[model samples]
Target: MSRPNPAVFIAFLVAVIVVLGSVTLAKGGFYLAKHEGDTLHLLQILFRMASGEWPHLDFMTPIGLLAFAPVVLFLNLGLGVGISILLSQVLLAFILLPAVFWAGMSRLPRRAAYLFGLSVLVLVMALVHGETERSVSISMHYNRWAWAVSYVVIVLAVLPPREIRNDVLDGLIIGVGLAFLALCKVTYFAAFLVPVVVGLLANGNTKALRGALASGLAVALIVSVFATLDFWVAYLNDLREVSASTVRPAPGFGLRTIVMAPAYLGASAVALGAIILLRQAGEMTLGLALLLLAPGFIYVTWQNFGNDPQWLMLLAVLLLVPEVRPELRNSFGWPLAQALGVAAAIAIAFAAPSMLNLAYSPFRHLSLDPADYQPILVRNPEHHDLQVREIRANRVDGVVALDVPGSGLEDRVGKAKRDEERVSFQGTPLPYCELQMGIVAWFEAIVTDLEQNGFAEGRRVFVADLFMGHWMFSSLDRLEHGAPWYYGGLPGIDSADYLLVPLCPTSLSVRKDILETIEESGIAVTEVRKAPLYWLYSFDRDG
Candidate 1:
């Protein structure tokens, strides 16, 4: 690494404190603009953890424990979930501060290093998931945190130090970053693991490899000691179950589209061009490492919900740092340095929208009028700080296809012989109904009705739909072994006293899958009651 710049590091620290503090002070509470469903799912995990339950053992989820651990820690300390979230991001930034500092100071110029640190911190602290959207929400926050770690890891691995070299620090950063990925989101670990190792080796940083291995192992040992060795088995089982389940395999576009679709093709071209330019500039080792990382980059983007190519900033940074001679030129006779600069600009252009959105979110949150929002977890007045739009919490909306038989719309749409594909429960054909919004209202109403009907506190009713966030709002007990968001295979069903099937489900496909699976299992269930919201059926455990 180059001689460390104290001024740059100090400036970065000040920026972190000022930015995060300003946002926290501005909101006075956490405010969400959208994605209430995701927030509720997060609350379920946090609620369970706060209640002394363990993930994988007490609930089913493919997400790793570290994803929720930081926030849960603050929650257990008596902070509201909203502040817990903000504090967790602050904690993550500090946890990663040394690595970001080392990587930035080692590879980048003073200004670039400061920007690098600031960017990573902004991503970690941003209230919204990445996109061009101006609205703020803490949806898919773990994804953002994983991407921040990835940015640090890639920079550290791909760039050799300019002058100073601390092999121990380098290895520890790589190891801790990778271990965090494994414990927070395994998809990132699986995607970048090989490439990171190859990058370190290709750069001839062999001395750091042993430290990396030791650090990673040490992290694993600690987790096993606390969460127990069986945690790995349960974790893997959740992963395997989700992998096999047809529900929500991908959040947005498919893998192929993420790789080569029109929206993504330009970024792919920029990455390839950067790789080739690095090779042409005679930086063969870095080029090869980047080439290997390209696929992993695409895989991570495909796995994330919005498919935001957050790695573009890292690409830009890498392009800026190569010390190629001024005279070097590619086949087009374009000066290699300028070519790299132009490529970097294009990468920045592709990433600008999301980056700007992330950087500006805290300030935007400051401008929101508090009178417009309401507490999401209505029963938990202590968590009144976590707020959402009142309309979103109260107004329910759904979409149902028109079934005008005489109009022949069904036939024209190829639904004439849809019987084989129709969703049915107990020999009854279900309509095409899907809830689109007001998830808070949906769950709150169900729980309220359930309590009023004498199916009160301590009851564990498994909703036959995608999300089971019922316990977060009411006195009802969280379903043992239940999934916050259903990935499939009827998790927690055996432990459920009653199955509540929503007439209009959040995901019709998930409801269909769950009901079919239940029927195949031959679990006898008799109707208990029916309401406008859902049908409650008690399991005939003896039968």
Candidate 2:
């Protein structure tokens, strides 16, 4: 029997995934606080987008508008995060897996179809499985979407299309792909130009290339004009904020991760050598592609070594396995290499559980502590770093604060049981469980104290990290004051009654800046609450 159509087969796979997701979500009660804030943020962005409020003018996402629209559209219509994720998976499955399936099934021997399918699963794991550094749920992280777009772009950039389409379909795909990437941090978007241009020539399909370029430009032009009319100042501010996000404390990521640069450079060089020695167009194109993707990938990794180097790793494995080629499929070497690839993919999938825990342990929204405010003590001489000592001293005075924005009351029925059930934390330790338990317990005690002390209803908090604040207190209004993007000042700072803050050491500078901003606004605030990891300040509206 002939092999199944690659697109048709992957479509079926995606359907299974969606069905599985639905079944898992139907069981309900899975909550990861790591996921909570993110869900709210996406909802916020989608709402804003629906209202014609694009980035810079108000809310923002690092990825381009194209990537967010479909998933956000599904979500804004009152669908749960499960459906959002399912839809995202479907979209990505269609956009990315099809290409991967095509690469294996079209080029390799017919018998190697299983290898292609297994390879795709391994790549998906790399794309969406691992727990992020900040206890973010795998489902919530933007990295998942980023990787989805990046994988397809990386693969397409290096490998020429096997067939150039005469219709607008390929152009639409390419255009939409590039447009989705357009809103990404500028440097990352720019890095793909070489490969895209090279692919244009290598494919020798002027129609597809011209169509792609035109469609991309048209999309960009429209977005730009809209931004210019809507909020050009906000758009300019957004560009500046993107630059500033990279301006954090130096040596942010580990040195071990940093070493990946030279390693990537070496790998690219070897691929280049292979291209020169082999003297084949396909080989040369791949080698060049590897060479081009290496620096960009390495740079981003160095900036933030999150998840899915395994995407590259999986691709590398596929590329390195020689016996999968049609002519060599029957050779003994073919079976051995193919087995090894399958084994490696299995090993990665197997390791994902521990990786999920070791990296970000399970957090459920179980009991909250209704504790009294606890005073903290710190001695400057005892600290090794001046920064730490200063931060501790400031913490004691309640000069800076971090608090989850909202009423400290959401762990009930969970947005109520059914709505909560709509999100499944698959990569989480609970495996589709909802309700954020304490991996490191969230400071719900702090929220409880503020609520008891009269800082509860109709109040807004300037969250140090929306992911944390929104999760703990989804009921409250939020102002994302923790990042530079919100530097322009909270819109209604004077009217707000409380300045909530994260009391953690990492928030010292954020707290300091936000406090300064509030002070400059001339609003009077009295430190009303302090607990481990949080600070609450009540405003004196009369003053």
Candidate 3:
């Protein structure tokens, strides 16, 4: 064997560095919750899993399991939240880049492949660091990553020259990849399936197709069986508790949001164009389409649900078109086709720079330290100047008793009694419990750390903001016990001994009510605070 081309090796190395560096920079300070509701659910799952409990169905996003389960199980090794998150980030970077590069290099010309790799790097960086609150955190968005991986697999699977000998293996690989992709986000399963089915029929191999179908069915059956078991044993129980709880529904994406729509359209157009170009280009088309569509498709999928079909459309375009193979180029005097190919390449290159720039700039900002600008906690006397101390804490494993203002039949009757004063309605649908855009990750890191440090079974009762309560406790746990404040109304005040609230500007603004609630309940609140900002709360059972 002759020595490998140094240029190709350099290109691959550069691609790897760019992808890894961008991801690392974008995820500066590790992962934090971009959405509170999702974070809470993640934390609940982490807590449950740590305690040998299975996750409920709603919490089991396929992407999350792919990225997080391994990290949570293997790498955590009983470390604090901050350390675990940092390790997870490292692991993600390592796993994501190689997989991405493998997908790109298998098809495109070396230069185009490198560019494609760079584009993926830029796109991920941009999304991770975008100022929009929804961009951060991958816990609930496992489908996005799965789609990226699947796009690559689909392209490669379709690229090889049709051969009976390779058919079974190819079918098996595609089937399995698609199955996993589907598990992560069911919508994506449809996208991959279209191309797989088309390829099987186009190849005219009944045995190969049947084997592929059987493998897919087997995988699906296995997953469904586990899912059903998990649901009956864990999810159903959680669901009932959540349904009966008084916590208001967390906000969702607004109907008028323009971001998801435009992104979808742009992605669809590019993906379709790529597929068309690839298919018309012949044998290399599948690989080319895969390389081109992976980044754009991943980005769009992360932003919205509808773009996966667009990716599939692109894949179809690649499969349906027939062009001269790269190796067969000298056999044909196809001047017009060659010109079209050159033109497509140029168009793709022209569009790439702007897209790369769009993805890279935002991530640069994410790497900055939040503490550089301001202290972690400010104002309130109880939490003032608390940033310097180290608060050794661990995840305390007790069922979080979350209460909403209007939870039960009895509470509704109580609402009628206090309707005249209007004070009863005042606290209904409490605003403080609402999930903030970027706080969930912080809470998760904290809880994860706390539990690993022997706090899993601790008796520290958290009397927290409505947002915190909603996120930290399951609906079932919240409903069965009323709010922590409700427990304060009991004969003894030992139930809600700790009140944890984030020390962001919003939390500082609500300092008065938070403190007043703690004081009126006769509980001594101690802020074990440290920060550029911190989650501030008092932790005393009795005043």
Candidate 4:
């Protein structure tokens, strides 16, 4: 038995680092900007968990709950977001490196194997870069990261080794890895299962097949039970609101879509052409071709078919090929084929990197200066002057509400008022109001925050809009009329204590009606200077 080449391992490690390092650096360029929803939400959950709070199921996406739980648990020792992301990326690279090395060793010569691994690394980097570039606005979405991680694991696990019996553990490990991937994103479950099923049928391993099937079913059962229970408990406690919303864009079978088939065919043809050229070189050359082609086929098919099982049929043709059989070892052509195969593999490996450099060039042109954006802590003098002073005086610890009024502020006020009207107009019909109120129903959040922070002792709470006062003051145990309403709601509508309401913009009837109701309800309304964007209204509930 030949000892494994240390060079192959070293090459694999270097490739993995290079791929991950480049992507991470590119992502870091946008660190000054706010992370997207997925990342923020994940970090929030992690923070809460680390602080000894139970992970809130409602706050997580279905698959995210599983993917985040371990990371949060591991990072509970006060690790920051940057450290957590780095750790995740490192784990992904380690998991991928072994598979690339094994796949190369099984099919190609040591040198060819190294080249094969290098090519895969380049392709993966290119794909990830493309995904990251497209996801700039939504960088916080953790699921994309989760999916990328799963893709790396799945490809490595599925690659066949040179000596199948020597690596019996690979299949079981793949099975367990697939289970975790399925838990994170159920769609990938098909990707692993289909290939396993095909391999079993081709090999005619009844006992092994039975075990794989049983294990898969057992995992599915356990996950489904847990998820169902979670949903029920979360919903009944009013901790989660479930709504069915979907985007079903019309399927386009355009010229571009048609063009994709030829591209894939061309890639496969090139890979096979390399294999034929390398035939005389050795069994390792053929094995390298099989390893690369197998995962690439699975990935391409899944991209097109949305993870259909029928696509596994393509692997059957691979099994039938004469060169794949163990008995045929060196029967194919030699020296000339080997040279051509090596040349082709090297060419294909360079393709992805060249394309990626072209794609990333545009982003590289932009300057990533933090000074371009305003600081979140900076006070807007026009709006925060009085409110900041008042907060300083009263020592309020929570968010200070502002009393700015403009079309933007009115939209929020109008939405709240309209939702309230819709609920009341319908005679307080339980479900009707519940469904129509949207997020506005959470008006109690302001008062809840205020009370929890002892804001009542200060006898005043800063607000962005006077309309927000309706919700805050109504919920307060006692109200103060002279208390200032801080202008904070819409940008450019900032005024301290003086409520700015823009009338040049058409008034939303809901805001107008709500204001009248507040006035009738004994909330004093003082109208001040009217600007093109907002009108000033001072409300003193204590009067």
Candidate 5:
């Protein structure tokens, strides 16, 4: 079959973007089903950037600048938050479109190229973060965006060009994709860099290697000049701080679980099976390169919140060779081509749920009833676009064990020692309770409670909890140098006026850790105000 026209593929991708973008915009806002805390964190970052603050400079975050820069660019142009976010994805797809086209056209067969382009575009434009969850959310949108970029880079590097080879062009794409991953989220860059380099070298793409290095260095130099040399140091510092955080080291599941857990074992086996089949088919270099790439794939999945295996779709495509020779057989006497085909099909099956969910999310958004949702940022009208379901926003839910003094279970157990480890602040033990939902209500009530008591304006509150988004809901000023979501250490503590300890904190362990760290630091805090919702303590650093 003749190769599909490159223009036709590019046009098809653009059309999909336009259709998805239009449908997303038709909603006039973004509605989230879950992950309100994460959405708030993203809001804080965008707000800080809009107010002339930079990540790792005026604020603390492990997320790289590029993650928010695209949205910030649209925001700077005076667009609403929802519109900015939507447009940013559209912009990202377009930005990465050239590389997508090149990789698809050069490396993949005609139909596969179309599918490849569509996959990248879907990842870029999808409203919800990847998962089988039908709910729509903008949380961790950057991760999806980063994965899209990774697809392009891996496709270009691992797969040899079937149609035409342009070493310089291929290298530039790989370099820019790597740099974008670095600037957007370093986890991807760190995970894929070695394997990508190895793949290029294994293929003897020497000119592409040189081109990649120069382009990567050039991009880094330009960023350094613009963002200043201190930016890199600050970025590294933020990453290091996050790395040490006991409150939240990894979002979900351990690295081992990601690779070996029952839920993930099938995908992992399929990946390994692909490697074995590739080698059996006399593609030793490709197989070896894939072997090196597997750990990185696992690492990225382990690092992400939902632990969705975003690499499977790409792996499925990678396994699809232009020609599958029937003569090749493995030691088991099975035809290598058919075995590879089965493996790729299994990979697709593993990936289909999330991929289908991602592709269908915008349509899901369109069907949502406006009456069912309310704005997350209650005070800011410009942010009226960011909304959550009223039930999720208004209804607070938590797990509270029946530990009544005369309860039969307690009597039977003779009082568990775990109860002895209750989190305490200022020598008073806090209730062992944690909030599982109603983040919007939590923030709104606290802000209102503070306002009612005249501790509202110009106060920098260091919330002793997992998330610090109270400032986003009210007139309260952000904790200078504070984290949107606490990673580790007492960030912005010295600059804080009050340490607000919630009655029902989001993460009890986080609250305990923060309070303990503060106590160890010897920062004197005196109880200033007590309410049903929280206890406010005035920081006395001088003492």
Candidate 6:
């Protein structure tokens, strides 16, 4: 019965604050600063779910709907979109910061733990606060959560409990993590699952193996029951979107990783090489490093643009953990930790400049007047109708005859605009990027003109543009006659009577083949005409 150290307690609190505070403050750096903001359309999906419209069979998404748990709860609790996101972030930070702190404290001295935690936190923040090609403006939560939980799983697997109660709890934790990965995104699940299973097998821990197997099966069974109720065929079909390589760039490693992560790759290899070639293989550190890095290194090669440094920072820390224990501590491991830390620092330093520029670039934007950054609805009351170019008409006698252009999205939403427009709206809390805003404004004027001149929303309209499709869904979620547009959007474009297609930038961004197919569709084309930015077309199947 020894008394705890007061100094260590104070140090722990300070370390947690420093680590957590920095991450919290950095959220402002990019809470919604990107060109398109956080417009992955999760909130829209949640809105549909709250209103009793399930995706897959109702809508189509390559991303799993199970990822919307936070939003679903928020919607149920009646939280506004803004509040929901903030709460979501706060929840994530609360969970993530402690996990990071514990990992640092587990292996290192108190002072060293603080430093390790700070470094890892910064790396994670920087990774989230910017855009990567692979992430495509995703707020690094997906990557960070998966990494954080995977680290916890690794620690648990390496140090299983002796007590039955503790062992069961650990198994549950791993099970929930795997379940979250399964729902959040499949790639993340695969990333950890492959390495972890191999690591456990290599270690030959049969008890641990059985526990992990049971955990996975339990989660699978639960998900299976729900998916069966939700329509397994639709869920399976929705998965096809990830395989649409032509639509989005393929991620993961190759020769490019060699060029991108030379330092990290070289350093990781050397760490593994030291144990094997130098014959200090008591802890299987190199084997574990190999298992972790085998997939991770390649993934990082193309992860979030180039030089997967920030993520590498956390990965290096995780790989270094097993070697940091008092008994296991060796001549090889300490130096390896320091080397990986240096490598991470060096990598983060290189990648910081571009993202930093983007984050602060809104202030320096030259083209738009300051008024454009103000809330559009304040400037124009009809902005909802204007931005979307159509509204659902209200009819009392079962024949709604109001002249609303599109009825899907609300006027209060700034999410209607294009990516470029949203970027231009930087510093304004709106999600529309610069490109997106410009397109929205243009469509408002153009579509208003055409409708006034006699064009109208027919029984059905095909939104060829992906964002356009989302705009349509944010307003309405009709699935009665839906069919597959592609794989990522609501599956009902071909069933429509009229086709609304934007050319060049918007269409080009959707999918190359889709734009090409629309251009070659040979349907009745009403030339709403073209501009320098894009060509607007309205096609009629009846004609």
Q: Per-residue lDDT of 247-333 in model 3, one digit per residue for the tens? A: 322123333332246634454455555555554455453545355445544544444532222233324323333445544333344
Question: Model 1 Cα displacement at 101 (Å)?
Answer: 1.1
TM-score of each: 0.96, 0.61, 0.51, 0.46, 0.96, 0.64
Off by over 4 Å in 5: 412-421
Model 4: CA > 4 A from native: 1-7, 18-57, 60-62, 69-74, 95-160, 204-244, 248-543
Tell me the tens digit of each residue's lDDT in model 6 across 228-343: 65555776666765465345444334445554466455545544443342224254643554556455545534443333433434334343333332343346555544444454
State the lDDT at 484 in candidate 6.
Answer: 28
For 66-103, candidate 4 gives per-residue lDDT tens digits of: 45555564466555444454445445445556655544
Q: Which ten residues in a row have the lowest lDDT in candidate 3?
A: 386-395
Candidates in order have lDDT scores of 0.85, 0.44, 0.42, 0.37, 0.87, 0.44
- Candidate 5 per-residue lDDT, tens place, 139-237, comes to 899899999999999888887878699999998999988998998999999999999999888888888989999999899999889878888899999
Candidate 2 residue-wise lDDT, 347-459, digit = tens: 34533453444222222111211131111111112211101112222223222212223645434434433432121111221112222222123434445565666666566
Over 4 Å off in model 3, which ranges? 1-41, 57-64, 74-76, 89-106, 115-141, 161-172, 203-367, 373-543
Better of 2 and 6 by TM-score: 6
Deviation in angstroms for 311 in model 2? 4.0
Candidate 1 residue lDDT tens string, 128-182: 8988877789999999999899889888887888766898999998888899999
Clashes of each: 2, 22, 22, 35, 0, 33
What's the CA error at residue 269 for candidate 5, in Å? 1.2
Candidate 4 local accuracy as lDDT?
0.37
* TM-score, model 4 to reference: 0.46
